[model samples]
Target: MIPELDGATWHKSTYSGNSGGCVERGILPTGRQAVRDTKDRERGALLFGPSAWQAFVNAVRDGEFGG
Candidate 1:
């Protein structure tokens, strides 16, 4: 189960400036990663472990998400 999330400093992707489809991210105290919709920060967020987060970042760098 995801742990309690509070006081996390959420940051949005650099490419998400002024774009309607923007995603925000944050780092958890446990070194895990957190992601949420920039349009709705008060809602729920998706959590990812360090390894998973790294992999996703790499994938994005490789244009795996159809950048």
Candidate 2:
């Protein structure tokens, strides 16, 4: 289980609107990224190392996962 999440600042995408259908992102103390469902904050999160997170973001930007 990851630690230090209590102090992590969480935020959703600006494009998320108010549909309550997006995940929130947090930057962990170790510079890793954590993602959790916006509608279920207490359910823990998916943690990713910096490189993996960047790769995922790049893939999203490139439409690798398809919209």
Candidate 3:
């Protein structure tokens, strides 16, 4: 089930440069991660289970998407 984001702490990457098109990520109470567009927060977010989120993060760190 998706967790509520009412009081979640969302933050964007420092490495996101000065672009206004970056996204934000927040940790839900259930330990899942929620991601949303920084510029369109009103649209809500995509919730990922802990393991799926970890795998995605690892892939990014490994440059799997080639930037």
Candidate 4:
């Protein structure tokens, strides 16, 4: 089940590229992570459990999605 995101505070990384084409992440009330596009806040977000979010971050750090 999705957690309540009403009061979630989303933030983008300072290391994000200058293109402004990145996603912001927020921690939900249930401890899951929520992600949404920087340019489309009204579109909603994707929710991920703590472990899944960690794995995704690790993959990105490892360049799994390419530089």
Candidate 5:
């Protein structure tokens, strides 16, 4: 089934805690990744190219950004 182009496709991180601070991710029709703050949906999302998104994910997995 074709995914919805709207906000319906956005999803929260499985690792997100109960804390109010969180973000959602979505895959755009352009194959780019979109990230937006959960607290403010109208604020829009930050789009990332596939490679950039992969690099960011890899960095996170590698613990490049200290928790």
Candidate 6:
């Protein structure tokens, strides 16, 4: 079950900057992950479970998304 995850402390991606292409991430105490656009923190965030997040990271590392 997903836990209540408001108020999580978010961190910007290392690749993010003031150039307007930024992604912010936050890991909840429940191990879920949250992502949002750095330029609009007030907007809704996208949440992912730990397993899904890991899979996404692995895919990125494998260049599955065609970086």
Which model scores highest in lDDT? 2
TM-scores of all predicted structures = 0.80, 0.82, 0.81, 0.80, 0.78, 0.75
Candidate 4: deviation at residue 54, Å? 1.0
Which lDDT tens digits does candidate 6 get at residues 1-67? 2234475778889977678889988888877888888888677688889889998789878999874
Write down the lDDT that model 5 would get.
Answer: 0.79
| Top model number, TM-score | 2
Show where candidate 4 strays beyond 4 Å. 1-3
Candidate 6: stretches off by over 4 Å: 1-5
Error of 2 at 56 (Å): 0.8
Candidate 2 lands at a TM-score of 0.82
Write model 3 residue lDDT over 1-67, tens digit each, in one string: 3348876788996667775769899977778889988888788898889889999999989999886
Off by over 4 Å in 1: 1-3
lDDT of 2 by residue, 1-67 (tens): 4567877888896667776678889988888898888887788998889999999889989999876
Worst 10 residues of 2 by lDDT: 13-22
Clashes of each: 0, 0, 0, 0, 0, 0
Candidate 4 lDDT, 1-67, residue by residue in tens: 3348786878896666888878889877778889888888788888889899999999989999997
lDDT (Cα, tens digit) per residue for candidate 5, span 1-67? 2233463468897777898879889887778888878888777777789999999889989999998
List per-prediction Cα lDDT, in the order shown.
0.81, 0.84, 0.83, 0.83, 0.79, 0.80
- Candidate RMSDs in Å, in order, are 2.2, 1.6, 2.3, 2.4, 4.6, 3.2
lDDT of residue 21 for candidate 6: 88
Worst ten in a row by lDDT for model 1? 1-10
